[model samples]
Target chain A: MILATSLAIAAMFAAGAYLMLKRDLIRLIAGMILIGNAANLFIMASGLRRGAAPILPLDEPTADPLVQAMVLTAIVISFATAALALALVYRVYISHYSVDLSRLSAAEEQQAERDEPMTEDLRESVRDDTDGEASPDGRHAREAAIR
Target chain B: MIAVPIAVLWFGGFVLAVLDGTRKPAAWLSVAVLTSAILSTMALGITVYQDGPMSLAVGGWSLGVGITLRVDMLSIVFALLSQGVLLAALIYEVVNGVGARIYPAVVLFMGLGLTGLVFTGDAFNFYVFFEISMISAYVLVSYGESPRQFRAAFVFITVNLLGSVFFLIGISAIYHTTGFLDMYRIRDQMPLVQENPAILSATIIFVAFSIKLGLFPFHFWLPAVYTGTRPSVAAILSGALANIGTYGLIRFGADIFPRELRQAAPVLIALGTASIIYGAIQALSRHATNEVLAYSAIGQVGYILIALGIGGPAGYAAAVLYTVLNSTNKALLFLSGSLRGWLAGAAFAIGAFSVAGVPPASGFLGKMALFQVGIAEDRPMLVALIFLGGALSFVYMFQLYRRRTAEIEAHGSSPWGAQVVVVMLALVILGIGVWPDPLLNLVERAALSLPEAQVP
Candidate 1:
């Protein structure tokens, strides 16, 4: 039973790692879920294969109580992590129109236009070339350049 | 009596903060609760110093069945350090008006979890407290409401959850093999299960803890997650949460699985050395203010792993001291970043120096002890790697300092609150560096309580 469980966990880990490497954010979340499950199985397998229940018994010796307690803790932490990841996914969808990484990079480039300078020195250079009044602000210059 | 008051204060404060809804009252309530917690922990420390270790069993179930809270020199010392760092974080938040009611509640709960983590003897109870600490941490990290924060918290939660699962699996396996939950009882039956099943269980446990500690190969998520969080959260996570991993390792790895750990020491040491170099290189290459500190923490934790891998009283003491110093200094650095708008960059630099083990700081003192332990263990190569790591820290911290100071000079001072915290934290760091005897003695006494390993 332990051997079978270990193999199942190994398979889960392999699949999770593959998904984690994918560029899509959703896939990454899936990967995390898989990995978390795999780890849970691995920890559960640590106890010897055929042990009594961890609860104390009047007639029989109790199973290892420490592991049972630790498992309970692990479960609670894992649940919280899953909830947080879901919220992050929602954030990604709202910010980027699309959750695609490549498209998001393109959006950032478009936003870079706001940082360009429009000063008197640059306006003077533009005026000498075109013999036209400078817009005083970079907006006209950028509009003209974009056009 | 002391424990009851502290515990009640912590739980009550948490409840009150949740009920108050208003930010100010919750913040003040949290501050009052935490202040008292700190005082109580100090009182406990003094009592422990005078009376030695003390234990109180809940509901009279004796040692094995009922939950037990034990305060030895070690638990008290860690509690004190945690309290001090939390207080600093609280002050920074209060001064900066980052004082959401939830922030204070999360902190109070985090403190409660940490305190409970140190004292609880029941394995299940340990998990309960750990979750209490970590769930609050998840909230705290994402408290900034920024996209970056959301992303970071997501990653942090994912990785840590996986680690917790591994921890659970390991614990369950141990239960199946041993039929006993108590550490004292587990030790007695250890010799019976020293074969294949135990070895496998030990390996699973190691992986779980290694991930938690952010050891090499498993530390990929740490730098990014830490860099993205708020400086206060980052400080607490780097300083306090990270130490829990090492503390768990010491408790489970050394105490519960001694023979297995001894057999696995070389691999553990190798990983430690790799992390030292890896984290240092990553930190040195980073130009981001927070990333530098994040990487530095990774490297510092590596040093603790090395100390644990060495497995002796001296090594254990060094590990304990490293935990204390690293957490405090890291908190100081991260908190300073939040307080000073102009010094964010400089605070990172100073933090890098403190964490990387540079001279005239607690980090340096901690590293010196770790290196001494390495030398005594005859691992000259490990010692060299540690020094090399320290050098990398110096380079990165200086680079960060120069960059930030130039920026500050260019922009002028931004805020006084941040500057004040930075100055105060720097003084604490320096004081600990120059006069570490008192702290070192506490760590040494704490280390003595662990069952002695026959030095191989």
Candidate 2:
């Protein structure tokens, strides 16, 4: 039983790691779910036992129920997080038009480049040019402010 | 009374969750709820100090059988710090005009989660509260609805989920080896556990927290999240949310795994030194103010780790003091950095000076405490490292102040009311630095809550 549990955990973790490395956000969430389940299994394995029900009037040895309760709580929490992640990924898709992390980050990088002038020497130019709506620095400042 | 603070936040969160927090009344209501929560936590702190740790076992079960909610001096101190930072940030947002309807609710829920985790004595319960707070943070990270925020949220969620899994694995390993979920019971049974598993779990737990803390090696996600989010959220992330990492490290290391901490002292010191040097160098190169502060946050926690590595009563007390001081300083800087008024400039300067360990700011007290620990241990190398880290911080902070505030043409933007709040926080920090006796006594009491460290 112990051997089987260890092998199962190892397999789940391996698969999770593999999927987590994928570019797609959905795959990443799936990977997280797999890893979360692996942790749940580990909690159960901690108190693995062959026994009667954990209830009153038990005449035989009872399996440790504490770990079961913990695993249940963990599963619920993971489920909620997964839901939130899915929502966030959907939002990302809507805004960036890509679920692939590399693509999304590339878009963000371009945006950051455009906004870079809001920082240094451009600050004085932008502030002074605020009166000139046609000024490129003012345009960048307006874009930066909108964000 | 033990449950009042959490109850207030939870109930307030539920109510605000159903309302439009962008409106004035709802925002003020959230502030009032948080202020009441802070007062309750203060009362609880006094109660714990006078009567020792307050504990309640759920459902009328025996001490070891039921889940426990315990508040000691350490827990209450952290609770107060997190709650206070949250309140300040929340009010800053409210005064600035909340951008989203769910803003007040999410912040309240975060307070509930942080307070619950600090007060819980059960390990699994801690994980549950941790997730509660983390999920709210996920939503909060993307509050601005910008494309940059979306990317930042993705990275933050992915990295933190991985960290959480590692923590869960460590918890399961502890339960398997020690057969207890209650923290006090785990501490008692830890000695019986064999060396290898104990060490493995300890390492796993350390890595998990290191990720949350944005330590030198695992800090890839921190700068993006802090820079992408709005100023108030960044403040909350550094000032309030990051407490979990520091609190978890101290509680698990000094209390549950003292032997392992002792065994890994050299490693802690090495990692800490690397973090300080790396973070300082990175901040020096970053031109953006938030990015500089983000990297500075990473560097500042190294001092906490170094103090923890020193491993004595004075060391633990120093760790606590440094953490509290750093959180306030970061909060003030992040909050004031958004405003353009002269008041905001003065506030930012106070925060900058504090971070560089100058006198008349609370950060000086924190640095002094660490220097005492280093000198008392006769670890001249640690003393030298502290001096070097301080000098680098002074330079970066000076650079940041000169670039951002010196050319302030006029109150550029943001409301004067919001600017006042930032200045008020700076004053509080300056007050603490000038008269640090009360804060010092609080931290010393907190350190005493840990079982006395075994002298090597």
Candidate 3:
């Protein structure tokens, strides 16, 4: 039974990793959810194989209360996290009109061009003197040289 | 009595911060509350040092059943480092009128959670407190006006939440095997789980914490999040929040896992070495000021883990000292750029020197001790790695310093208050380095108190 559980978790982890590597932000969030569930199941299987509940009668010795409490807390916290992640995804979708991370990167590149002058000012101040006098040539030269 | 007062101060401050608008009054209130809490914590720490570890059971329950707050030298030292740097940050924010009440509230709750995390005896309670701390951190990371912050917070929250779930599952499994939640109880009961099922559970727990600590491959979220957040918030998180990961690893890794598993210590050392190199390389490659500092933090955390993996009196002391010194220096550097003018720029230079493990600062002393430990263990490779790590740190930090200082020289002067705080932190960093006997002694005492492990 433990072996089966372990295999299942491994499979889920692989799926999660594949999805996470994709360029879509929504898929990445889904991948995170899958990975979290796999870890949760793996944790549960690490204990004794006995299927009995953790609660104990007055006469009977109790199973580990600590483990039960931890699992419950973990479930709640994960739920909250999922909600927050989805909210963020909604914001991303609204702004970029697509959940693809690659598309978002393209948008950022355009934004960077618009913001370049301010950065140039900062670069001028940062280099101060040595390269400061060579600004138009040096800054553009550096950028062009890099490309 | 100490626990009650500190809790009231922290929780109360948190509440006030939430209710108050993003105004100067709220910032002042946060400063006032945290200052008092720091004073009270210092008194408690001195008392613990003079006496020994102090414990208080919530609701007067017996140990191993009810939540217990244990105050020892180790907890006190972390608390002192966290509270002291946070206080400085609060002052900076107040003076700058970056007076967002939510930020202070999140910081206070983070502090509260950390205090409880360090002091709590019950394992389940630790998880509860960790969530409280993390949720607040999530909000804080996204609280700034920048869009990049929103993206960074989303990624960070997702990764950490997954880790937390794994942590919970591991805790449950341990309980099922041993029927215990208290760390001391679990330590005593570890014999029952010494075989396959129990050992596997322990491994899961370690992996969960490793992710949180940003160990090696698990560290992707850290640099982006740290760079994206406001400088003041970044300071508190790097200075205080990240330390929780290492502290958790130590509390669980040393106490719960079987001794044989610890034989894998060299693997952790290797990972630490890798992180050190990777983070430094990234920092050197970055031009964004915060990005550079963020990567530097990653490298410093790697150094801490390496010390802990060594697992001896000297190793433990080195870890603790490194934690304190690194946290302080990092906080100073992170906040320096936000200061008003040129003086702030100078402060950044001094802070960068301290962080790069230069002489006449606590970072140097801590690295020296860590190097000595590696040599004593006859691990010449690890020793060389430590030296390489130090040199890498210098390259990146000096690059940042030189870049920023030039900018300041070109621009106007920074506000006087910002300059003063930066200079003060630098002086303190230097003082600790020159006369480290007192701090070293404190760490020694704390390390000795930990229950001895049966080394394989």
On DockQ, the leading prediction is: 2
lDDT digits (tens) for residues A18-83 of candidate 2: 899998999999999999989888988888465766897888999888888888888988898899
Score candidate 2 by TM-score against the native. 0.93
How far is each candidate from the true structure, as Cα RMSD in Å?
Answer: 9.2, 7.9, 6.4
DockQ ranking of the models: 2, 3, 1
Residue-by-residue lDDT tens digits, candidate 1, B230-315: 87888788777776788788877777888887888888888888888888888764655677777777777888888888978898
Docking band of candidate 1: acceptable
The TM-score of candidate 1's chain A against the true chain A comes to 0.62
Clashes of each: 14, 0, 6
Q: What value does DockQ give for candidate 2?
A: 0.47
Q: State TM-scores per candidate.
A: 0.83, 0.93, 0.86
* C-alpha lDDT score of every prediction, in listed order: 0.73, 0.90, 0.74
> lDDT winner among the candidates?
2
Alpha carbon deviation, residue B149, candidate 2 (Å): 1.3
DockQ for each of the predicted structures, in order?
A: 0.26, 0.47, 0.28
- The digit string of per-residue lDDT tens for model 1 on A21-109 reads 67687887788778877766665665443357755444565554544455455655666677767776787677555666556445433
Chain B TM-scores, listed for every candidate in order, come to 0.93, 0.98, 0.94
lDDT of 3 by residue, B78-131 (tens): 777877887887777766666455777776777777777877777878888888
